[model samples]
Target: MSASRPVRRVDRQALQGLAHPLRVQLYDALVSEGAATASELGRRLGESSGSTSYHLRQLERHGFVETDPARGTGRERWWRATEEDLRTRGADFEDDPSAAEAYRILDTEWARSRRGRHESWRASRREWPMPWREAAGESTSHLRLDVEETAELMAEVVALMSSWAERTDGRDGDPRYRSVEVQANVFPNGRPPGVSTD
Candidate 1:
């Protein structure tokens, strides 16, 4: 949340490197788990250790992750996310079809990750206290705005989210504290019924 690390803006090369579903899965695991050995991540993702290690090195080459020296041993290496957050702008690859395809693949993986998390939360909600169960749910809103306005709104929301992230970092010692996932997205809707732009 309040990570001292800067958000890494992924370039096309990195996007291509992460396009594989398994690599995307491994990257997410490394970020969420803080640090992990290839074997540990492999177990979580149902992949072989050799495969995970190969993909982890692929991530390292693209600067998405790195060796966690403090957590590594003589026989095993630990890896961690290089950045607290990562982002890519599809428009950046507008002229390159291959890069654009890579972006799409990564996007699909991101959506899958979100769906998995949502399902997991729903499945486990019963184990949580009533207060938490009541507080956890989805909210949706639709607004009409020009491109500039939409950009401004997204920036504001990100700032607000960052503030909360900063505040929650040191509360791990609290018995009642639990990690919560926050997802925010705003994009232009595809052609609605009775609308045409072609």
Candidate 2:
């Protein structure tokens, strides 16, 4: 993905465009499930095709998605999420009230979506194959690291994931294999042990 396109630094306008709940979900579905027509997405998301199509256009206006020519026909159009790594700098919106609010809403929705997806997976894990079930689990650890170290560690972990991701790109010829979802959360606790705020 890095070789293909540069990272997309989402600006205030784009961030505000994606602040809509349905639009965010549509973008998420496109990225995770690959390209699809608006109708197909509507079916999967239990929304009207008209509604999905409208929101898809809105997403496109902000460069969040684009037309997928290979998947389209005369009467239908397919869309795919951009390969760019979308990022927003919180500091940019620190002084702007409106932009900050938009950022807060989008950020909150993102976190909520992650939690919801994980909970859904937990609920449905039993239906999956035994091998997958055995391989899937979560753990919590208390790490000793400052802010900068934590960021560096996360960057390393992302690089590792990017490498692993290349192996699963394109069609799945092997029924024995499945796309796995990996999630990680790292943050600082309020002052480490024996540290005084004063």
Candidate 3:
């Protein structure tokens, strides 16, 4: 999980646009589903087509998403998240009241996810028809490295992960493996115990 290099940095305008609850949900839907038409997105979010389309245009205007690449013959615009991940200064965002609006986006997204899972009893935990499910595992290791070493290690990890993503191109995909969910992160936990990991 530690090795993949991030491809782009999301900036303030993009963050601000994604700050809206509907837009954020739209973003998540696009990212998870790969691409969706405005009408499809509207139905998924329980909003009207006009509303979804307007916000989608706003998203495109700000470059949060673009026309999905696979639609070669169609005239309909399909949208998806533009960047590899959503990023922000967590501490800074938490400190300012205005910045806290971003949390609304996240909260609404989570609520929607939960609502979809339990929308009905038959569809409760029993439902395997949902488009996707998530799972994760974590590990920690102690390391002593200067700033330069830390940077080098991160870059090497990214290269290795990208190489793996590349090498998988030729592999046979099981029908189940068509959807791949992978996330990797490495960040400072500050000085570990007594040592100045600073």
Which runs in model 2 stand beyond 4 Å of their true positions? 1-5, 171-177, 191-198
User: Which stretches of model 1 miss by more than 4 angstroms?
Assistant: 1-4, 169-177, 190-198
Candidate 2 lDDT over 1-198, as tens digits, reads 324345678888898899888888889887766788999999988999999999999999989999987677889999998767687867889888999988887878778778878898989988988988898889889998877999998888876777666545554335666556788776787877699899
User: Number of clashes in model 2?
Assistant: 0
lDDT of 1: 0.82
lDDT of 3 by residue, 151-176 (tens): 78887876775776555533332455
Model 3 is weakest, by summed lDDT over 10 consecutive residues, at: 129-138
Flag clash pairs in model 3.
Answer: 3-157, 3-158
TM-score of each: 0.85, 0.85, 0.57
**Candidate 2: minimum summed lDDT over ten consecutive residues — where?**
165-174
TM-score of candidate 2 on Cα atoms, chains taken together: 0.85
Off by over 4 Å in 3: 1-7, 72-75, 107-198
In candidate 2, which residue pairs get closer than 3 Å at backbone N, Cα or C atoms, i.e. clash? none
